[model samples]
Target: MTRIPHETSGEPNPLRALGLDTLRRRTSMKWRTYPEDVLPLWVAEMDVPLAEPVVRAVTDALALGDTGYPAGTAYAEALADFAGKRWGWAGLAVERTAIVPDVMLGAVEMIKLVTGPGDAVVVNTPVYPPFFEFVTHMDRQVAQAPLGPDLRIDPGTLEESFRRAVADGRRAAFLLCSPHNPTGTVHTAEELSTVARLAERYGVRVVADEIHAPLVLDGADFVPYLSVPGGESGLSLMSASKAWNLAGLKAALAIAGPAAGADLARLPEEVSHGPSHLGVIAHSAALRDGNAWLDALLAGLDDNRSLLSDLLAEYLPGIVHRPGEATYLAWLDCRALGLGDDPAQVFLHRGRVALNSGLPFGTGGAGHVRLNLATAPEVLTEAVRRMAAVLE
Candidate 1:
């Protein structure tokens, strides 16, 4: 495959740097879930090479036979440094953070700290499918606060859900997907502040899944939910897994705001054992030394975003896609195609292109499909072509 370098940075676009044959040879779910004939662009996994720093870190640990239990606050400290330098926020207190297996597991532990069984765990739909499945599996009731027409948070809807969630003074928790999944909408500071205020008013603890924090593309800013004025009691789950293509590494951090230190401290010590030592080493290295590579990946994603829009307009004109400001996921509205609620199935079965069906994402998910944009530009274009062919 021809290597496409980022326009400004001159760094090779990770998405285009790897060839299809190279990708297919891997055993990851994104490539292996479907047969060789189907184009798989359904999951969160990014189709890219590992950052050099991450590779070196893991390789060095193995070379030294340093495979053992994870120890120290290196990951937390590295994240704090990255947060301060990148997001202009220095409030990541290492003492208030705990290592978890991954973002979802961290979220589960954080939710457990704030609510009991059967308590309502609020979410904005259509959201990441796991947000519904995992919360429900934990014995907590899932409450919906669907986003507005613009794919941003609907304060009225959110407030109404909050009111219902905490009815009769019941304990509730909000699982906030910052730089939201599927949609890729980066929540602004003002919007997040409003979320904080409302959560405070309703006595609902806010657990922000900020795994996509580093993927904020051009034209937006990522407001760390705990950095807002009214967010002192919020908890956040962050990781390099999503941003740096380290999902298989299985490492994440659960950060607590100043006021929520006590609650975070209540997290079971065994929870820390879930993350592999190699995973910790790789994640810490990514945070500490992966900026240049991350910048290249972001630029590639930006290019792919524009490319996708153009391709959709030229081919699948009926599909409505409001390009998101963060992450590499594009939530495309397929309702206009008259495909009913699950267009992904039509595309998959007929077009031989796999996509995430909207039905499982809940609420607004129906008539929609989430497309992963972290692959090569050619693959993305081909995926759209196949999708357009389905309508023909």
Candidate 2:
């Protein structure tokens, strides 16, 4: 696959950011989930406009009436190339990659292929809600390891869970969330190396959920799992969905490291048949031609992350807010405000603002809410204002 690099300034130019009226017109779940009176900022979807390359690719596909089943290895090749350029990941093996319907589905299938029925799947607590849901959906048991005080994975707790997972001579796998969701904590190379070593010692396979790799904001470096020394036996589920705002596209890739290639090859062929053709096309184009657009989006999101910090400090001074280094989600700690375990309920009922309930995110989620920071600056400003009004 051929790729063209588009140079971009690291800082966001204000002119490129979206405005309030342009965003409110969106008909996505973020907008439609709440009544017009409430300011919605819960869902993972972004309020920004689509990238030009992505839009053009989808439009061309529709014009050609190319809506059919997905084919070929173009998507994999494109991502491999993008990975090399974006994150210094030069070890991407296109032939060892398999396309799937989406990241969660790809992860579940990868878990099934590597481990038997009733195998335990370990996950970090207060993580993405689907990590909890998909493990149960596959009939595998879920093992929880709560994050440390800084919201990063706890090494000691992780080892304990790994030991418990295979205690009875049972098989297990770690569903590692890189640049972790809800909290948006980007894992460092050292942290991932530790996880890889731990997995090796525990006789467990590691499947990294790296769907957020491309969205690592300034000051945080995204290290691909397979690029780590002890990670050659791990598997990775990647997609353009999260970063490119293409979640509804229905396409993702399950990648295997050199040592794990044979295991991935064992994946059921029916799994590869699930991706949509247009989704594959859009993803490929995004990887090949969407870097400049992606850079701009990242710059805007960087501004928003900083913007949220200011907004929180000014309005909701009691709430603990950590500006995320990656992802558009801000995990807010509302414990100091005495909002109970699920503050989202309080915000919606009193402040008329919709935010993701942190309760469903598993352990350590009490007294928290996941605020989507991908909207226009005005929307974020209003969300905090509403939240503060209720407290006042």
Which 10 successive residues of model 1 have the least lDDT summed?
A: 1-10
TM-scores for all candidates? 0.97, 0.95
Candidate 2 global lDDT: 0.88
**Each prediction's number of clashing residue pairs:** 0, 0
Residue-wise C-alpha lDDT for candidate 1, range 191-265, written one tens digit per residue: 999999999999999999999999987546777999998899999999999999999888999999999999999
Best by lDDT, which number? Answer: 1
Candidate 2 lDDT trough over 10 residues, lowest sum: 1-10
Clashing pairs in 1: none
Residue-wise C-alpha lDDT for candidate 2, range 287-380, written one tens digit per residue: 8888877888887788888888898899988999877788888999999998899899999999999999999999989899999888777778
Q: At residue 285, what lDDT does model 2 achieve?
A: 91
Stretches off by above 4 angstroms in model 2 are 1-25
